[model samples]
Each structure stands twice: as structure tokens, then as C-alpha cells.
Target: MKHLFTPYTLKSLELKNRVVMPPMCQYAVSSKDGIVNDWHYNHYVSRAIGGAGLIIIEMTDVEPNGRTTDFDLGLWSDDQIAPLKRIIDACHQYGAKVGIQIAHAGRKAEDADIPVAPSAIPYDENSKMPHALTTEETKEMVEKFRLAAERAIKAGVDTIELHAAHGYLIHQFQSAFTNKRTDEYGRDLALFGKQVIRAVKGVMPAQMPLIVRISAREYVDGGYGIDESIAFSKEYKDAGVDLIHVSSGGEGPILAHGKPGTHAAYQVPLARDIKQALKVPVIAVGRLDEPVLANSVIGNEEADLVAVGRGMLRNPYWALEAATALGKETEIPGVYGAGFSLKK
Candidate 1:
């Protein structure tokens, strides 16, 4: 049976194992220039050294104001490319294939003096109201995403993940709760996301797979659930998405009726549904920190890959430790081999 330690591949992206370090923002950019600084470098490269098969860089915005905060990473300028390339090169040397999540925070861009979104909706009562994009401006956003993908490719990424989940820009456009537009975007909820997929795909090498991260189930009232997500995911798949990274619940406050489950593997079922419905590979994430539980998801064919976010934050060598705990042999750095050997 396939397990967590098994090798996996998608198009040009090859992984030594199914262990993925999902994009978790560090908010560590000290200069506010959106460049990858020492903290960002050390944060990702360590996970690579610790044996993460795929280390996805955090939610990197396409424009300066598109970021959730001033400190978030951005690919808006050529200056940012080299720093990111440096990190990717280091991660590659340590045997971890790198991918970066290109995104815009939309109404969720907290630090923007005035944020932009599909509509003028504020995320909540305390959130700032955003300027709805004009049709022309909306089209420009697509170009921004395309440019970001180009920069990521230039920086040596094996794959690129569009951040369509977590109540970010793409998620805002796709979710009715957040997107209240009446133009072409409103007429077709999936249009923005589809355009983005096509735009980003255009810049990527044909052999390089494109991953779209989607919140398969929104946990707020009137927010989309599995059925709605599957439909849009199909549109995305048809538009050139190669993989779906299934996550859930970033729209708004979780209502009592729509509260997301806090249990381990709670989101696996959603990932499975998307995988089955779309007939595509998916990376399952959400509280799947335990080695045995993560292994079970792959062993049962519930998902294609497993992402350990919080667990990885707690231990950079989470993959190596998991290998030891599960009795699976993986290539450990010679210096770290002694630690794993103790398990035998």
C-alpha cells in the first residue's frame, strides 16, 4: 500500500516522499520590501535539510498592496527574484523540490491603506471596506498573477501553487460570501480563478504542473460547501490545473451550524471527494500532524500527498522523525543519520 514515505511525482515535479511542508506565512520580512530575508531563508531551508519532500514557500503576493501585511513576501519586482532563487537553490541542494504559492490577499490585505477585492465587502465588522475592482483593473490582476508565475519559474521552482484558498484574493472572488460583484466576475464565480489558472499556466513550462489550492468547504453560513467547490474545481481542472491542494474554512467567522471539525484528518474527506470527482491528484492538509494518521490517508488512498503545517512548525525534522516512528527508511543527511539510527 502507498504510505506517507512513498515517492510521488506530478509532471516535472518529483518528490522523494509524500511529505509536504505547506505554505505557512512567517510574516518575517523585516524591511517591508517583500524580499526573502535571512529568516525566510533559514525557515524554509531547514525544513529541506530536515527531509521535507516538498517545501512550498508561503503565500507570496503578486503586488505590494496585494499582501496581507507589509511584511509578507511579494514577487512584484525583479529585485525579489534573486532572494527567492537563493532560497530555492538551498532547498534543492538539500533534496527538497520547491514550489511557491502566488496570491493576492484581496480584502484581507490588512496593511493596505485601502485594500481591493472582487466587491466592496469588508471581511468583517472591524475589517476595512475594500474598493471593488473595475473590469479593466480586474483583468490587470490576472496579468499580475501571470508575472508572478514567471518570476517563480525564473527563481527555479519545480511547481507553482496559486493561492485560491484561505479567504485570500482568489478565494474572495470564488466565494459568494466575500464576492458581491455584479459584473462578469459575479456572473461567473469561477471565472476569475479560471482566468488566473490560464494566465499562470501560460507562463509555466508545459511539463511543470500547476497546483490550485482551494477551500473545498467554507465553514461560514451561506458560504460554499463541498458541492459548490467540486463544481468550481471542475472549471479549474478544465482550465489547466494539474493538482488540487484541498483545504477548507477561511471565508469568515465560523458559524455554529458550519463550524469546521477540529479533529485530525477532518479535511481528508473533502480532499477525497475532490480527487474522486475531478479525477485528479490532491494534496490533503489540515491538522494531519500525526505520522500514523497521515500515513493512513495515503495508505487508504484518501489523498495523493500529505501536508504537515503546524507539526512541521514544531519540528523542522518532522518528516525524518515520522520516518523513524513509522519504521520507514528515508535518506537522512549523514550528520542526522545517527539520530534516526537510534530508532533501530
Candidate 2:
């Protein structure tokens, strides 16, 4: 039976274990230049050291204004490559494959002078109204994703994740609540995501996988849900997406169907649904901090991988501890092993 410690292989990608540290924004970039610094290096490298099989870097914007904040990582410039390369190289040294979540914040870009989205919709009443992208500019945005993928390949990422979740640029385009355009984009909600995926894949190595994160169940009244998400997941898989990182909400929370419960493995069902619907691998995330619960998802064959978010943030050594708890054989650094019971 598969467990969290089982080595997972997708195409040419071989993970030492199934523990994935999903992209959690560090907001540690020292300048608006979007160049990674010591904090990012230390942050990601620590997780790799802690024994995460895949350390997916945070929502790295494809363009400056696409950022949720000025502090988020960016791949728009060649200068940003080396700093990110530094992190990827360090993670590789620790036997962890590193992937980057290339994204655009769109209407949710809190720090932009004026955020842009599929339409001129404000994320919420408190948020600033965003400028709508012209059809030509929308094409330009797709090119930006392609360029970002090229830079990520240059930085030597083992894989690349397109951030389409949490009310970000791509999600804004996918969710009907945020996108109210009269163009081809709004008519076909999956069009933008497909274009971006195709664009990113064009520059990526054939063996490398592309993961797309999606909010499978948006809480708002008119937002997309599991069925719609499944339909789009199929479209994405057809467009070269190798995996789907299942997440929920972020489209201006309405919670009319009731908010998602704050329980362990809350989003595993979403992942499972997509996997079953598309026969595609999925990374189950959201409050899967417990070792047993995380392992259960894999053991039950519900998901291909498990992503630990806040749990990892609070304890960089979560994976190491999980290994010890589950009695899974792992190379815990000698220095850290002393902290675990030596009786075993």
C-alpha cells in the first residue's frame, strides 16, 4: 500500500517521497524588484532539509503588476533567475525536487497602482476596481506566461505549477463571479487557462510536468463548484496539465453553501474527485498537517501527493517528524535524529 513516504514517479520526475510543501507566499522579498533574497533561500531550503519530496516555491508572478504584493517572487526579468536558481540548487542538494508556481494576481493584486483582470471587476467592495484587459492585452498576458516558463526552465525547476487558484489571475478568468466580459474569454471560461498552459508547456522540457492549482469549490453564490471544476480539469489535462493541485474558496467568499469545514484533509475530496474524473494525479492540500491523515490520503489512493501548508510553516521539520511518527525509513540528519526517540 502506498503511504506518504512512498517514492512517487510521474513521467521522468522521481520524488523521494510524497510529501509536498505547497506554494505558500513568504512575502520575504526585500525589494519591489521581486528578486529573491536570503529569507527565501533559507525558507525553501529549510523545508527541503526537513525532507519534503517536492518544494513548490510560492506564487511567483509572471509580471510585476501581476503580483499580489510587491514582495512576491517574479520571473519577469532575467536578473530574478539566479536568486531562484540558488534556492532550486540548494533544494536539489537535499534530494528534493523543486517546482515554481508561476502566477498572476490580476484583480487581486493588492499593491498594484491598478490591478487588471478578465473584466473590470473589483475583488470585493474593499478592493480597488481593476482595469479590464483588452483582447490584445489578454494575448500579451499569455505570452508573458510563456516567457515566465522559459525563465523558470532556465532557473532549472524540475516542474512548473500554474497558479489558477485563490482568486488570482487565472482563477478570475475561470470563475464567472469575477469574469464578466463579452469576449471569447468570458464565453469560454477555460480558454485563458488553456492558453496559459499551452504557452507555459511550449518552453518547458517535455519530461517536466505542469501542475495547475484550482479552487474546485468556490464559496460564493455564483462561483464554480466541483462539477464545473471537473469539466475544466479535463480541459486543462487536455492542454498539457499533468497534475491538479486541489484547493478551494478565494473568489470573494460568500459561503452560501456553507463554508468548508476546518478539519483535517478537508480538500482531499476535491482532489479525489478530480483524480477520479480525469484519471490525473492530484496534490491534496488544506489542513493536512497530521502525519496519519496525510498518509491516509495516499494509502487510500485518494491522491498522488499530499501538500502540507500551515503545518509546514509552523514546523519546517514536519516531514521529518512525520517520518518518525509513521516509522518510515528516512535519512533524518544525525543532528535532528537525536531529538526523536532513539529507542526504535
Evaluate all candidate structures by whole-model CA lDDT and list the values in order.
0.93, 0.91
Query: Alpha carbon lDDT of residue 329, candidate 2?
Result: 84
lDDT of 1 by residue, 43-118 (tens): 9999999999999999999999999999999999999999999999999998999999999999999999999999
TM-score of each: 0.98, 0.97
- Top TM-score hit: 1
Instruction: Give the TM-score (vs. native) of candidate 1.
Output: 0.98
Tens-digit lDDT string for candidate 2 (35-82): 999998899999998999999999999889999998888999999999
